[model samples]
Target: MEDLSIQHVHLELSENLEAHRTQGFSNANALVVRRGAPFRVSVQLKGRPFNPTTDYLRIRVSLGRLYVLMPVTFSRRAPSSRWSAHIDPTTSNKQTLFISICAPASSPVGSYRVQLSVFTQDRQRSAANGSFILLCNPWCSEDEVYIPFEDQREEYVQSDSGLLFKGTPMNLVSRPWSFDQYEPGVLEACLNLLQVSPQHKRNRTKDYRNRCDPVYISRVVSAMINCEDDRGVLKGNWSNDYKQGVSPSKWTGSGDILKQWAQSGFSPVKYGQCWVFAAVMCTVMRVLGVPCRVVSNFNSAHDTNDNLVIEEYYSETGQKMNLSKDSIWNFHVWVECWMSRRDLGSEMDGWQVLDPTPQERSGGVFCCGPAPVKAIRSRRIDLLYDVPFVYAEVNADVHTIILGQGQVVGFSKDTEKVGSLICTKAVGFPRLQNITGDYKFIKGPTSTISSMSSTMSEDSTTSRGSSKGVLVSLSLDKSPVAGEPIRFMVKVMNKQSVTKRLKVHVNAQAKEYNHSPSDTFWENHAVLQLAPMEVTVLRNQILPAQFEHVDEDILINLAAVLEDMSSHERFLASEEFNITSPELIVQVAEESIVPNKDHAATVSFTNPFPHPVSGVLTVTGAGLIHGKTQFRMSTLRPGGRIEQNVTFNPSMAGVKMLQASLSLSDRNIVIRGFTMVHINRV
Candidate 1:
């Protein structure tokens, strides 16, 4: 009888093992999975084929220190999205086999190495090896992402969310923005950010908070957020002297950011504020299969010290004092991640905060959180991460101080303004969920304001905070059309019993939303005289060119300050508006196509403005184009129409979404359009 000993054994891993080999898939640490999901490892053997009735296939799986040994059975059916081949030992000399394993709840998250051997007789043993990484199965009820949630499932699953960008206090939160978490480069970037060192690559499965750990991944993001490195996004210089000289309109999605970052050789991408940082971070998290959401905290305090109060000192003439070390952003954005709290205790498991913006430093680095939301809510300040800092952002009070003749004059506090709205994307809807009560003590209505009189003799010269005295209101006249004047009305009231003189300043600036407003495109200054309890209205208009950049989305930020010259009390308030670009229209010849057949698609648009545009058009879709296809075009004359045609063949059977984007590089104009094509299997 022929010996059952195997001549040679080789192993590889991928859903498409053949294609993976052809594409040079050589990542030693490439395998990634969640518990309960089937992980497939492919094995190929060539030898004197042993009869399966006499020989057996034995496999050993090693996850860091944990190990499992199991026997493999031959099957003709292929695994889902995977390749498996049957071995007819009597006729076939070469055989390929797929071993699919599902990790149970007790299995820890980490890299797994597998060894396969054919052993039937006691004298023969032949082996081959391969490996993969595993994570907590968030989709399973046994995991933290689904275990603790009673809310609808969509909020935790949606890739697109609503954010309030253009309104007073950001009350309007339903403008839809996509997260595009499944972009290929986003996952690559997240992995590259985490596995930076060789040690990280070597010892990834050792600890929950180790270098390859998700917590460590979040930390790497923070340290890299200064916009000074290859993957950095925001340039966070809070000093009065810095300016974002270039404006790149509103980003379409996080995929754009990751693509730009990767294309630039990992160099710093332009213009990211808190929301931009939060939004992109949300994309990275979700792309890596982590459940994440963007959260906005209005009147977010940058409490320099551990104390939960941001103090503001104003001059007698009612000008804001920038004298304090503490600062409060108008609104601050951060990300909340879902995971089991292995670092903290069980009760702390839920949403953990992870800030990617270059804020204050922690542990000698610029990262923050994975600080448990439960811990922040319960006032557990002594945790390992920045609990006190995050707590201050959501629950701190704004302590306002007024000074007259360089001395303490008045003291006031605003509780409602800080953390007024804590919002995330509404589950399964195009709306926002206000989760403010989740952060604050909501049993009784929290106090909005508290005031006290302090002696002017004491030295109150050093305090500075954020305030727009007594909730002043500003109104916009009408919606702004592109290439049209922007108009707004500012109304100030003299609430005292006597007549008073007021110094009112209206500053209107055009800024991109991804950066702070620094340039004043238009301004109006006036000294007005008002009677007791009288209202004064100032109407201001700015020309279209003032707010319009060459080819960028302009954000109109209006800051109006009404200062009481006699009483030295001031009211400062601000509002925001959006200027949008025209859309690119796409019309398809047909809605459906048969598999392996070609369909023609046409995209067209007119240049409404006087200037000509020059750029590349990037077309992308899954199962349509093999990858993204780009076409370059130069200046067509002013008012010229751009109509182009491209042919796409369906590779698989399914509904496919095809999108085209025209990026005017020099002029910075972006026009996007999409259409759906059905690929029917015949």
Candidate 2:
């Protein structure tokens, strides 16, 4: 008889990672592989050839208290949702033996310790130890998060850079974001997010078990993105004040936020908005092997009472008031992840909405989602995981009212304003893909205003005036831009066959993109006299000096009100617009970009304001640059232009985006721009 003791075990990291499509994560020393796939390991014997009938082997995989032990046999079978092990007959010799191990597709994703125990006649003799990290499998058909399309998998799971749509639907702005899932310390930080979660802290075994499902994982990540409940990743700030920490707008990538959180001993990163929260959540999901994308809902409503309606109040002078708790954001961002809803049936399985912003609580925690998109489209609010909340966000009706002396003077119902548009980044492109049809059915415009009673007596008013009342319309003469005066026109028409004395009031207020209007920035008042059937067009311009002190990227609410001097009748029209910041020009000098080859690009900025301006220019790209490059730009006078050159080497092959942002001094403004580069494989 021979000892048949195991000498050493080798993990075929390169071969297994290549097969698992996780080659990008090979920077770690430990073996990294996706679940539901088989990985090879070789074992060397110390003494003699092992006979399968007498000498046996058992493989044990464990994470904390949860462990799975399986007998090594000659059974060469297809992999399934079960732990199995077998010796490779073709590679086994007298001194060394090759073995393949498979973790079930439903296995809990995390680091696992692999141990091989040798036995002779059921008695333990020798053992060997190894380790590997297991992640969710989007490429495996057996995985619940499996996506069939290759292009979509590459875009959602593999691509480290993306675009977040902001601004209004009429004027869409593609804000570039670096997912940076594979950046140094980013993947580790993503895993650390799970470790710091309240669920994992409460019960490690149960949390590990629940991670096998994408639904559980999404819910946990959603709550952990905000610091309201747990010591999460980012702190949300919508008050336009970021003195203590970095502003949410300054973040161009998730790598810095994640690393900051981890380095600070699980403290929350400062200042995040809706888009920032969604972008960071998308990065964590992608790093954990879940297909995810950020989505923007234009005119998204926050129905506080679950009534499927949002009430808005306005003053008699057309100024919007914050009297109601419910509000409508110009745009609200959230993430949609691809996974199967076994708990909600196959029909409900598909893209599910997971909002990371801490707007509301679910299941006694500040987490929301795993709500199926189909369920929301079907108006099935009875389902689990905050379906009614998301349903109201996109399908709620809006009631606009005007109050005078605590009485309703005017009222309008707009059925089409809420969720006018929904979109996400298109696959393999840097453009917007309209997904509005997925959330709701298209209906005809249904905005109607109730007839208001004339303040004048019937005998005093003409039939035409009583029938049509006063009609007011507002229009923008040109797109508003920073350092340029905003020009717009207000048209007021009188239909009565009588001379009328009227008072006109125009108000402009600066507001955050996701909140209600703040204090008025500019206003105008005038007295006008109109003859019978006469139209008045008032052209107005708000100079850059008037709003230069206002915050950057904030929307301007320009409203006009016409009051009948005698009748006391009021008509209101308002428009919400944003001042477009000057964009940087990023031109890649290389005609063809290949992996590991140096490339040069230029970042240019021209001062459009009349005064001198100085700022810091920061350039970053996930696969194109090593980290981020920052340069302090000197003060440039009016009409002065400056160009900074950047040179870097591409690390991987894929479609990469180079993004630049200029943060100005003496003002709160951030100008951003990006250009796409297709890097070919070396």
Top TM-score model: 2
lDDT at position 654, candidate 1: 44
Tens digit of lDDT per residue, candidate 2, span 1-682?
A: 6577999998988899888887777666668888988899999988768888898899999986899999898897745867999999898986788999998899998888989988877585899998888999998999999999999999999988899987766556779999988888888898889988999999999999998999999999999999999999999998777899998888999999999999999999998999999999999999899999999998899999989999977787878898988999888999999999999899998899999999998998887899999999999999988999999999999776767798876665667778888999999999888898899997875222111111111112232235556666787765677899988888877777888888888899888887889888799999888898898988989999999977666888778777789878767677776777889999999788899878899999999998999999999998788888999999999999999999878887878889999999978889888999888877
TM-score of each prediction:
0.70, 0.94
Compute the lDDT of residue 412 as modeled in candidate 2: 59
Model 1: per-residue Cα lDDT over 1-682, one tens digit each = 4555444443334453222111112233265565545555555555555556777877777755556776666664544322222443343433555555555543554456877778865647777776665554456665455444534333454333334332224333232344544444555665554444233455755533352245555555555544543346545533323245323334545666666666676666666656667777776665444577878775678888878888865544334556688766656778888777766778887788988777777786667887888888889999968888999988888776766577655555656556666777665544557677777776466433111111111112222242222223576665555545767676765555678787777776654433345456677788888787777777888776665572344355666665667656555555655554555676679855887888889888777655667888877664566556788977866678888898888765644566677887665556666665666878
RMSD vs true structure, all candidates: 7.9, 4.2
Residue 669 lDDT (model 2): 88
Could you tell me which residue pairs clash in candidate 2? none
For model 1 the local lDDT of residue 191 reads 53
Q: Residue 543's C-alpha lDDT in candidate 1?
A: 77
Residue-level error in angstroms, candidate 1, position 130: 3.7
The 10 consecutive residues of candidate 1 with the worst lDDT sum are 449-458
